[model samples]
Target: MSEPTSPESNPHLTLVDHPLVQHKLTLMRAKATSTATFRQLLREISLLLGYEALRTLPLTDTVIETPMQEMKAPVLAGKKLAVVSILRAGNGLLDGILELAPSARVGFVGLYRDEETLKPVQYYCKVPSDLADRPVLALDPMLATGNSSVAAVDLLKEKGAQDIRFLCLLAAPEGVARMKEAHPDVKIVTASLDEKLNEKGYIVPGLGDAGDRMFGTK
Candidate 1:
């Protein structure tokens, strides 16, 4: 998520093309990948994506005494980070990120897309306090049509989340464009930006439905 190898127009978007990430993604993408394996791979890849998402977090040096000597150590600064998942499917990514930031303030925004319109419908939303003070990480595995993502971000901003970063495994160019147009200030970190979304509003050349694959529901 550090470089822009794909659509270079959007400065806020990051495509994580590291070899390890790509390797795991390929496995997850295959039609034969099982539910248990897909879940595990999502967890593993999320850890990597989480690493990149929080890469620019501010650090402050604090005095600490080591066994050898007293020294200053760099640690996270400011308010604790707020990790908000766009629920259900988002939980897959959330579990892995929580492992990275165990103490991070967790939140959820439940939004499901309307099948016919591909529009987001809010069912629930509860986020951390002092969102303006924390760096919010809003996550979902797929950024397909971007409607859900934009709606989610709009909700986050309404709750006073000024510093927000979006995390996803796969993104469609349409989704990226919509996010950029809707919230230019937010950064998008993803493993891959696939081709356009399909007629049914699914990311084409995409890894099926992330939630279904992760849960074996479909």
Candidate 2:
């Protein structure tokens, strides 16, 4: 993946606002939303967002012999899709997308920022072979600093993934800028673009700790 000299110049960043998506996202953001309710909302939102994300996928027509006659049917063109979740938090989005596109291949990447260096270190990674031949969608819940997200995409590109898309529930402006500067080729699909990150590295006004909220860990 090529680094972007200026992330602000990238034109593929998008925010989706379908009625169902907007409504569910609101509930997810509410403080009163319980863990069980949050998880359910994330799953539902993921499927709705996945629909919008895959809307432009290319299709090719193939002639098929029907019982009565021959007809052309449309089928997805190119290699199968790959859904790579960025672990714990990303898993919430993954569940719903998988429900919508069960045939898509799945992969996982686990990374945690080192407190001392503030850099991402991979703990686990397993992607499908021939990544360059497939369209890859990477999912995560929050995009705060974008360090992990950018690093993950860098690794994916190193592994020969050419077509990649990043999906998230919420994003901070700084995170967006960082990802745009680091990986301009990747498209971002998110529900909301919040303000800057606070000193502690959380998205200001963001729903706190997506993983904890979704899993009710604390």
Candidate 3:
């Protein structure tokens, strides 16, 4: 796929503009939207995005017996699905996706960037064994500088997750570039692309800290 125009450009992003996602995104963007409302919108939008994310999941045709006769049916192929959330914020998206794919195994990775160093340091990391055998969907709310995200993906790779995709609510141009440079094989799905990251490494015009919004903590 071609690269996105810029960190601020939404044109290159794989945005699921379905009505439900758009509506909730609007609510999430409003300044007056309450913590409760933001949390709800995040869950709703995550589910909608998850639907699009899983569209290309591999499937196999199997013989099945219906009420009257045998028929061929499609079922998810091979290993069960795995959802790896990049900690607190990713958990918001993870919950919604899990509701839709409950059979999927769950994992968590916690890394926080050091503002001064612009590097990610791991605080917690845990993922299911045998990730190489399963399709893994890794999630985080914002892909800004890409430092933390790249680190998260590196950890996943170390664990042998070959089939991995990155999912986010918003992405910045710089972050996308960093991810593409570091992990070109990973597919990215997001709702919108915001302008470049601000001096503090936050996505411009992007939703604020997703973890804070989701948990009602500053």
Q: Which candidate has the highest lDDT of all? A: 1
Task: Give lDDT tens digits, candidate 3, residues 1-218.
Answer: 33544534432246666877777887887878888989888988899899888877999999999999999999999898989999879988988999989999999999988989889999999899899999999999999888899999999999999998889998888888888778878878888878788889988898788888789897
Off by over 4 Å in 2: 1-9, 65-69, 115-117
> For residues 135-210, what per-residue lDDT tens digits would candidate 2 score against the true structure?
8999998988899999899889988999998999988888888888788788888888887688778887999889
TM-score: which is higher, 1 or 2?
1
TM-score of 2: 0.92
Name the regions of candidate 1 deviating beyond 4 angstroms: 1-7
lDDT of each: 0.93, 0.86, 0.86
TM-scores of the models, in the given order? 0.96, 0.92, 0.93
For candidate 3, give the lDDT: 0.86
Report the poorest 10 consecutive residues by lDDT, candidate 2. Answer: 1-10
Estimate the TM-score for candidate 1: 0.96
- Sum up the clashes in candidate 2: 0
Indicate the TM-score of model 3: 0.93
